[model samples]
Structure formats: structure tokens, C-alpha cells
Target: MGHDTVETPNLSFGRGATPDRSTPYARYVRLDELHSLQHPRSKEPAELSFIVTTQVMELLFDLLRHEWTIARQALREDDLPAALAALRRGTHAQDVLVDSWDLLATMTPQEFNSFRSLFGEASGFQSAAFLHLEFLLGNKNAALLAMYDGMPGTQAGLTEALRAPSLYDEALALLARRGLLPPQEASEQRYRPSEEVAAAWRRVYTEPESATLRPLGEALLDVAERVTRWRQRHLSAVKRTMGGKPGSGGSSGLTWLRKSAEQDVFPELWTIRDGL
Candidate 1:
């Protein structure tokens, strides 16, 4: 019996075989729609980078929101490990969001001014994703919801988030279920720090082995710190590019950003650290 040698198939990607555009990667990612979103309103070459970078940040905001939602749901189900995993992922996404500022950090006032006027009344303040992210982080503000009044869908989405339990609320509820403290009241109103919540965080920090919430507390702090860092970088970027001028959306630009940066996400987490 004679044996014939068989040639193996050439599966070398991006070379021997033409790339399949119909693959799941292209379909799932929708690269065509994603790439098509960068529409610059100005002829300036830098405008393209600005538009793309802003779009990237918006996508990141949505990603972070999704992660927070997952974390909250996990907490609600008393799945501490899953909640921590989701929160850790969110922190990583936040770092990427912070670093994304580098893409626009070097823009001079003149460079931004070249196309700034073209976006009249359009500003980051009007970003629905960012607003939703803030709401999920427990920074609910009904006044901010007014900004989306004309857009029924976006406004309705924001209102829903506003009325839902925030990430911190879920964390507190989980801790309460574990007998760490009393259960937190789920409210759609703005978040106000409670002495009891602060004390619970202190207990978590002070007791390592006994406190089941220690790691969760740390994960929450990581998210809070990352958000603070992002706001700081955003403020710096805005200051460098626009100085103290009024924002495109009628905001007081640098002043508004500075004030917004002062807001501490998970305030109880930080206050607890000081006492620890």
C-alpha cells in the first residue's frame, strides 16, 4: 500500500487567506458604524482628532455605566465576587478614560478656537452617557435632567437612572445583608452621606479578617479614586484649551469644571479612610 502526502490548508491570517469581512468580529463590533461617527464640523486637521477622541470618551462612559450596572446587580444578588470583579473592571475602564485626555491635552487655545465656534451650544455637559454614568455613581441631580428636556428618549433614560438605586446604594445593601450595618433606604433622590455608612466603611477598613466587605470597600474606593483622577485630568485639559471662557453649552467652562471636580464619588469611602 502506498501513502500519498496531503498538503495542509494555509490558514495564515492577513496573508495567505483574504480576511473575511463577514466574520463575527466585524459584525459584532460594527466597525463601519463606529468609524463613521467621527464627523468633524471644521476643515481644521485637528478637528478630526477632537471629534474622534470625544467619541472615544463617550463610548468609555457607556462601558463604565454597563460595568456599574453589572456590579450593582451582582451586589443585589449577594454575589460579592462578581460585584468586585465588575467594579475592578470599571476601574480599569476609568483609567483608560483618564488617559484618553492625553489625546487632547496639548491642544492650544488657538487650535481649539479654530473649531470651537462651530459647535455652538454643544458641550460635554450635554453628554447623555456621562450624565447616566454620574447617576449610576450616586450623583443624582434632577436639575441636570432638565438639560435633556427636548430629547424625549434620552431624558426618559436619564430619569429612569435617576430613580434607580445607585452603585453605592447596592454596596450598602449588601453590607447590611451581611450584618455590617442597617440596610440603606433605596431612594431616587440625590445621595447624601450618612454617618452610619461612614462608620460601616471604617469598620471594614479597621477589620481585615472579620469584615467581609473589606475587599469590596477597597474596590469601591478604587473606582472613586479613578473617577476623581479623570475629573481632574478633564478639568486640566479644559483649562489648557479654553482658559476661563464660557463653555460651548453656556457653562462657565473652567469654573464649572473646577466645581464639578470637587465632587467626591463615594464620599463616605474617603471620609472613612481619613479616620482609619
Candidate 2:
């Protein structure tokens, strides 16, 4: 399976808009255009931090999605080394994403309130890039497409991601090829934990004969752990800034975030722990 990197059609950064290529630093990274993107809505100093942190997260989301796409394709081809390398790169990026919350973690409620109303109805929940990252992690929700009905191109790309087999799907399929058949189609199931799947993993951990699968299992667990940590930190940051207030774009704020943090990404890998 050939992999293609997702294109950011909305950004004007790299489409022949960059300066002369003679100076590698400015041209190669589009530093001038990147710095020009920050336009804070309010006069409050805290708003600048909010805008920059959110934009940073969007960039990290794209980076992680790119790595996961490669990992998914590599797994489909049964290329273990390739898949592991991509997964390793994604985990490193994930750690940076998880830490990005620190930039906004210290914002006092007064400081946040000072600028919160300036950007009315805008929400991080509407980020297409974050949604793409979730879809790659096997957390597909078709209903999210409605939010982007106004933007057909973005919706189409997300639709492709939602329908396609995710990185976890490929991992489970690889295990099944080696005789650990999961109970259902991994692509369709939404975090459905199967005892059969757990037992298969138990064998991978306990039975030395199944040693080849251990690295993959551990790599997946690493991803799940980092994602959970990210959500937890996000929830904490929200609670610190807004408490139980309603979220922007009509979400339930802390209530919604708490639920997201509790949700497990890779189920059987955790369920097999007691046996191990």
C-alpha cells in the first residue's frame, strides 16, 4: 500500500509564496510566512499565548497524522521494521503534543476571560487536523463530517480517513495473519474489547514462541499511553482556566474532556495486563 502525505490546502505557506531559495533557512522553513500567521484577536497578552499554543498543536497533529499514515501502510505490507520506525517517530511527536499544553497551563481565569469572548464561537473541537489524528487512531465518527459541510475539500479528506483502515486495524490484522484472529473487523469496531484479543496478546507476552509480536504490542501500548496523557493534560488545562463552563462551539467543556480522557485507545493491550 502506497502512502501519501496529507496536504494543507488552506495554508499559503509553501505554494511559491516563499522568498528566494538562496538562503536555506528562510526558504526551506518559510519562517517569514510562519511568523506572519499569528494575529491575536484581543489586546490581552494571554490571547497571544492561546493562539500560538493552539497553532502549535495543529502543526503537531499534522506531523503525527503523517507518521501514522506511514505506519499504517507499513503494517499493511507486513513491514515490521518500517512500521516500528514510524510508530517510534509518532510517539516522539506525541510527547511534544502532550507537552504543548504547558504553554496555556498557567493562564489565570481572569486572563482567559479577558480574551475568551473576543473569539466568539471558535473552538478547538472543530480542528480538522486533530480529527484526522483521531481517525488514524481508529476513533472514527462520521457525524463529525457535518461540521465541515461548508468546506467540501476538508470533509472529503476526512471522509477518506474515516472509511480507511486505521493504524490499529493494520496492527490487529498483522497479528491475525500470524494466527491471533480478533473477533470482529477492527476497522468497524469502536474500542470494543475482546477477550479473544486479550488472550492472543497474553500469548504474545508469555509464550516465548510469539516473541516476534512483542515489539509491536509494546509500541502500540506506548502510543495509547501518550494519547491518554495528552487528553488528561488537556482536561487539567481546561479545568484550570474555565472550570465546568460550557466549551466553545457548543461542547460541554470539562464534562466532555473528562470523558475523552477516560476513553482507552487500545483496549486489549490494557486488558491483557492482569494476566501478564
Candidate 3:
């Protein structure tokens, strides 16, 4: 009797194997390119986390801006369903943004100190997408526009955002169209919550079953709550990492964020809540 040695066939299931494009799972997410973007300036392992977290937050901010734009436009067209959908998606993205701070929150002051110098003169305060989001939410400040003057794309986009009606502004106009708010004002200035607008929101809250108004009011409230949570989380992250230290942008870190957080997204929404 002779013993025979058998060779096993090479199974093409490993990394070198060609991907089958026909399969649904075979489609590329371009994650190879996405994952390649995290180039931390320092050798510190914590620096990678810091950079990645900030980048992730920026991506979330972009998504939020996109959703809010749709929501604002929907409100302008008097399309409640479209506006509600956009608001709901923005709320979900806001949840992600709030949770992302947890990653940075875990960093001790010592860990942050390693890469803090690498971020010289750069801060979250200079986030253009964030500024645009603020503008879209009616927190417009002309001073912030100066930061983007060098970048034409960013400057142009932010300029347009500032000139356009804010989400709350569109909502208020919709209310006016429905006779819930007073007639639209003639001025095209930045939308400030008028006493009449606040009164209308109060009515919507008081009468919760008023067909279209109640849900719209609640949707706006949900967005406001999520936005507040994001701002608070951001302030807390800054405090946790840097304490009372000045921000990279030369402003007081936590102090500035706290003040910004205090400014409500939809002022009338919160103002009406107190009366309810």
C-alpha cells in the first residue's frame, strides 16, 4: 500500500481575490479613500482620535446644514410633510453629533496637550459649515463672515446662507400665510422673532390638534432641542479638554461656546414653552 500526497486547491476568498461587482455587497463605499484622510500631524495616538473626532463632527455639521436647507425650503413652499421629514433627519444627525463629543470627552487634559500645539491658530470656531448652520438657524453674526473671506467657495456659500431666510423665518412666514402669524413684514432683514410670531407659536402649542400647525410646531421644537443639546455638548467638550483657556481662534473657549449656546435656535419655540 502506497500513501499519496494531495495538494489543496487555492480558494479565491482572501484579499487577493477579485471582488464580484454583481453582488450588492461588492459595491464600493470608497471607504479606502475615506479612511486614508486621517493624517494626524503628531505621533501621539490621542491626536489621531482628536483629529478624527473633529473631522467627524464637521461631516455631521455638513449633513445638518444640508437637511436644514431642505427643511427651510419646504417651509417656504408650505410643504409641511417635506419640512417635517427634513427636520426629523436633522434631529437624527444631531444625535450623532452630540454623541461624537463623547470621544473627545474621554481625552484627559494631558492627552489633549500633546496635539494642542499642532492645532495652532485653528479652532472649531472657524468651522465654516458650523457657521453656515448657525446662519441657517437665525444666529447670523456678520463678524463670523470675515473668517471665510479668503476662501471664495466658503465665503460665497456663507454669504448666500446669511442673505437667505432662516429655517425659523420660513416657518414664521408659513404661519403668516396660514393666518397663524401676522402678515409678512416688508423688511428683508435678518429674521428676528416678533411678539406676533411668538404668540402664534403659543397658540399652536395651546391647540395641539390644529391639523397642520401643531405637528409643525412640535417638529420645530424637536429641532431646537437637538440643536441646543449639540451646542451644550460642544461647550462641555471644550471645557473638559481646555477648561477656561483661550480658544485657538483667540476667543475664550468655553465662555464663547456657552454664550452661543444660550442663543436659542427657534426663540419663539422655547418662549412659547414657558407660557404653556
Best by TM-score: 2
- lDDT winner: 2
- For each candidate in turn, the TM-score is 0.88, 0.90, 0.86
Instruction: Compare candidates 1 and 2 on lDDT and give the better one.
Output: 2
Residue 95 displacement in candidate 3 (angstroms): 0.3
2 versus 3: better TM-score goes to: 2
Q: RMSD to native for every prediction?
A: 5.3, 8.2, 7.3
lDDT of 3: 0.82
Computed on alpha carbons, the lDDT of every model, listed in order, comes to: 0.87, 0.88, 0.82
Residue 12 lDDT in candidate 1: 64
Ranking by lDDT: 2, 1, 3
Off by over 4 Å in 1: 1-25
Query: Taking the tens digit of each residue's C-alpha lDDT, what string does model 3 give over 190-236?
Result: 45767877888877777654555888888888988888888899888
At residue 186, what lDDT does model 2 achieve?
Answer: 53
Clashing pairs in 2: none
